[model samples]
Target: MTTASDDQKLASWRAFLLTYNTIMRRMEQEMQDEQDLPLTWYDILAHLDSAHRGALRMQELAESVLLSRSGLTRLVDRMERAGLVERHPCEEDRRGTYAVITNRGEETLFQAMPGHINSINQHFLQYLDVFDAQALLRVLTKVLEGERPAEGSQAEVIEGDQ
Candidate 1:
């Protein structure tokens, strides 16, 4: 037994899900084809390249990449093994660790930028007017600021909050 309201909500949710899935799949494919990098890895490198001193505290890196801490640690482990990034002790804080992009990581991002820009333009920017893009930024910011699970997700780690 389904009501019209339920059907409408379902439709709306489906639209959101499909949008996310399609964009991620296309972005991943484009990055792989042009850069030999996964989108997630590129995101990490991009964040580092734009960061202060091309490095960030581990917790900060995880939050910036929108990954749970453990997830980020695993990602970093893989990147470290690939020679794209390295982790070192934080100078100011003995308990803290920093993720620093290696020279290889910088080169990887440089190689990826043109393809990334083209993909972004084709799949994202060209579809939106400037006004819409600004509005979308605001909307996404609001969503990011929203509350998370009180207990946090299982995959989440209780490290320093970002």
Candidate 2:
């Protein structure tokens, strides 16, 4: 039995997914057109830059960049060829490997970051107001963490976190 609330939830879910895809596609296009950089590469490099020693273990990198291990391996290989990243053995676990960001990678990320930020702000953040942004942050955080916020936590979600 589908209630009005249930229908609304389904619509909300679809909206969230559609909006996410639209934003990502636009960002991807912007990155490629303006910076001549693939968004996936930019994402991987950005994650690595913030990681300890500008590197992450293969599995960790895959998880951080939301890629399958094999997919990440292929991309890393291409990046290595482009002198943007390199792979090295993990001393702690011989079976593990780390993907280290090269100097070129850091340089590329710095160059691309400014334009990417502008694109994000223009395409997505521009639509959100202050309290709406705050409320969204709270909601997304809860959803991502798979945990409900505390009692009265809803009250703390301001209208403008975006």
Candidate 3:
């Protein structure tokens, strides 16, 4: 019962998955070599660093990271022990908590950004001209808008927006 268009779309999705995995692997390897941080940890730190007040509620962090509650809790435990982040009680809700980026985390992310950019350029951007990059960005924006809630910006995640 499948149409040719559906087959083509499936193929495109597969290709996108393969390319994304390959690029992520390369970026992860480079990040490990240059900064000794896992891609997930870096992702968390980057999100926190860019968040309003350099912090986010635990649930917001989990959603932004695309991680489960328990997974984020464990990740934050490790990060906290490493002095990269700290947890604070939410002002409005006693039972709630926020993950705040520590000075060390900020410094680490600042240091890692250049290498991350270079890896992005080497693995993906270098192959694309400006026009291609712009077009790709437009397409990606569409995809992101489909997946992201209205409140979350590409650069920062804020509460009460969605």
Candidate 4:
């Protein structure tokens, strides 16, 4: 009962998954070998480092990193143990907490940035020309627009439940 359009969509989805997994694996390996950093840890550090005042509320950080709130909490716990980040209780909201990048986290991110950029350039960006990059940006932006959670939707509910 599948139509031609369904077949095309399936193929595109599979292709995207394959490319994403391949590129991420290569990048992860390169990062581990060159800087002894895991991509997830690097991602967390990068997000925290880029946030205003080098911090973000736990729920916001979870959303930014595409992690479930519980997953983010566990990851933050691990990072805190490593002296990479710290949790600060929010003054305005007693129930809320912020993740703040530490000096060690900043230093680690600075160390890993070169390898990360090189991995992107070598594995991904080099495959695109300017026009292709623009087209990709447009396509991805459109896709993300649809995927983003609605205001006060399940995402918010999940954050509150956590």
Candidate closest to the true structure, highest lDDT: 2
Once model 4 is optimally superposed onto the true structure by TM-score, how far is the C-alpha of residue 87 displaced, in angstroms? Answer: 1.0
Alpha-carbon lDDT, every model:
0.85, 0.89, 0.87, 0.88
lDDT of 1 by residue, 35-134 (tens): 7899999999998998888999999999888999999999999999999999999879999999999999999999998888888888778989989977
The digit string of per-residue lDDT tens for model 4 on 72-161 reads 999999999999999999999999999999999999999999889889999999999999987876666566556764543433433343
Better of 2 and 3 by TM-score: 2
Q: Among these predicted structures, which one has the highest TM-score?
A: 2
Backbone clash total for model 4 is 0
Residue pairs that clash (backbone atoms under 3 angstroms), model 4: none
Candidate 3 Cα RMSD (Å) = 4.0
Candidate 3 lDDT over 1-162, as tens digits, reads 889999998997898899899999999998999999888898999989889999999999999889999999999999999999999999899999999999999998999989988888898878899898777767666677667757455433222222
Q: Which parts of model 4 have CA positions greater than 4 angstroms off?
A: 149-162
Q: Lowest lDDT 10-mer window, candidate 1?
A: 153-162
Number of backbone collisions per candidate: 0, 10, 0, 0
After superposing candidate 2 on the true structure, give the runs of residues whose Cα lies further than 4 Å from its correct spot. Answer: 147-162
